[model samples]
Target: MIVVGVDGLRPGVLAVEWAAREAVVRAVPLRLVNVVPAWCLHDGPTGAVADIGAWMRNGGKSALAEAAAAARRVVGTVAVETSLLGGDPRRELIEVSEDADLLVVGDSGMGALRGLLVGSVALGVAGHAHCDVVVVRASAAGPRPEVVVGVDGSAAQTAVLDFAFREAAVRDAELRAVTAWNWRDPLGGPEASERALAEALAGRREIFPDVRVRTEVVEGSPVDVLRHAAAQAGLLVVGSRGRGVLAGMVLGSVSQALLHVAPCPLVVVRGR
Candidate 1:
């Protein structure tokens, strides 16, 4: 199933709509989830506190209802399910990711303030989720028929290629695999990057022969290269960590940076 977190916010509704369309393409069920903060509920049995808790629960249910309706509007015959959860939003969503094929959330969560590029919940879950996590953002140019992916000869390269190809095939979009070459690195030049990109995607073409692919090796920062390439793409897919990132880090610096600036929805695939 595709699980999407909805808070009734504009970005949250966009996430639901994206997930609904993805469900239809993948032929899976869509699950809309709204999580009430634990702080809203009280341990004591005070009447006022009880009333406030009830109000919060009701609000969460209403949000779920609206999310379900929005999903149905996107695809009326989609199998959609709604859930009202109570706990830490990040933890709850991460747990939900275990059973989900894809877990999606809005780039900005509720209580978003000016200058806050990405929401804490979205970042938290993206870094810790057990499965792939997609952070949805509205693109200025609207949806395009292309999926861009970052390719580095890292241990996670295979998984990243698999995801990029699958997504391209499902969306019937072009797959653009990009590799960034650092000029300072003598051993790994543009030529090396190109070879790595080709080798990483060697057999994926056969698996997804229908997906039109274009590969490039540009010399620059990984984040900057990918951000420009995905300016008009429908989706941007990358591994949780890149070759340059330390293994101890749950989220690579490049992936984290792109999450804040990528033009389209970004999917962080966990390395298996």
Candidate 2:
């Protein structure tokens, strides 16, 4: 099942709907989760404290019901489930991601502009979640979306490529395999670079024998190359680990930059 976390269900509703529809098309179950802040039900010294708490809970439940109904509308006959959680959104999402095949969340929520500079829930889940994480931006438009994945010739990248290829085949969209190289060491020689590129793409032709596969080997930063590629893509997928990010608590440079600047929605495949 693909679990989608909806916080307040604002601007993210469209992206969540699109993701749920994609899951339905893949014949996977869809689960919608809404996290309610505990402070919303806190009892203050003001009069009618109990009444206010009850009202807040009721409002939260109503909003969750509406989000669930909207999801059902987008996904015709797909299996759907809804849950209203109370606590930190990231913690709740991580707890639920245990049994899920994919976890989806919006890049940012309502009132997030003044609150968080970079989307926290998406980054948190992408960094620590055991399952694949899909972070949808506010301006994403769906329908036969394209899949873009990064390849760095690492074992983790192989898993990312496999996932991207399968997703492209299922969606009947183009899959772009990208590799970024920097010409820092001139003594490395072009022959070694060519051999490395070939090895990176080798042994993967059988995965998409008939699908369109395009590779790019450019001389620049990975983040810049990926951001450029993301301009024309519908979805961008990348591995959790790469040649960047020393601490490993967050996404690498390319993935992190794309998360904030990608023109389309982004997916960070974890545990690959």
Say which candidate scores most in lDDT.
1
| Residue-by-residue lDDT tens digits, candidate 2, 166-264 | 888877888777777766634244455556656766777675776677777666677787777777687888887775448634667666666777667
Index of the highest-TM-score prediction: 1
Candidates in order have lDDT scores of 0.86, 0.72
lDDT (tens digit, per residue) of candidate 1 on 112-168: 566788888888988999889898975442368899999877778889889999999
Using all chains and alpha carbons, the TM-scores for the candidates as numbered come to 0.94, 0.87
Candidate 2 Cα errors over 4 Å, as ranges: 38-52, 110-117, 142-144, 185-194, 247-250
RMSD of each: 1.8, 3.0
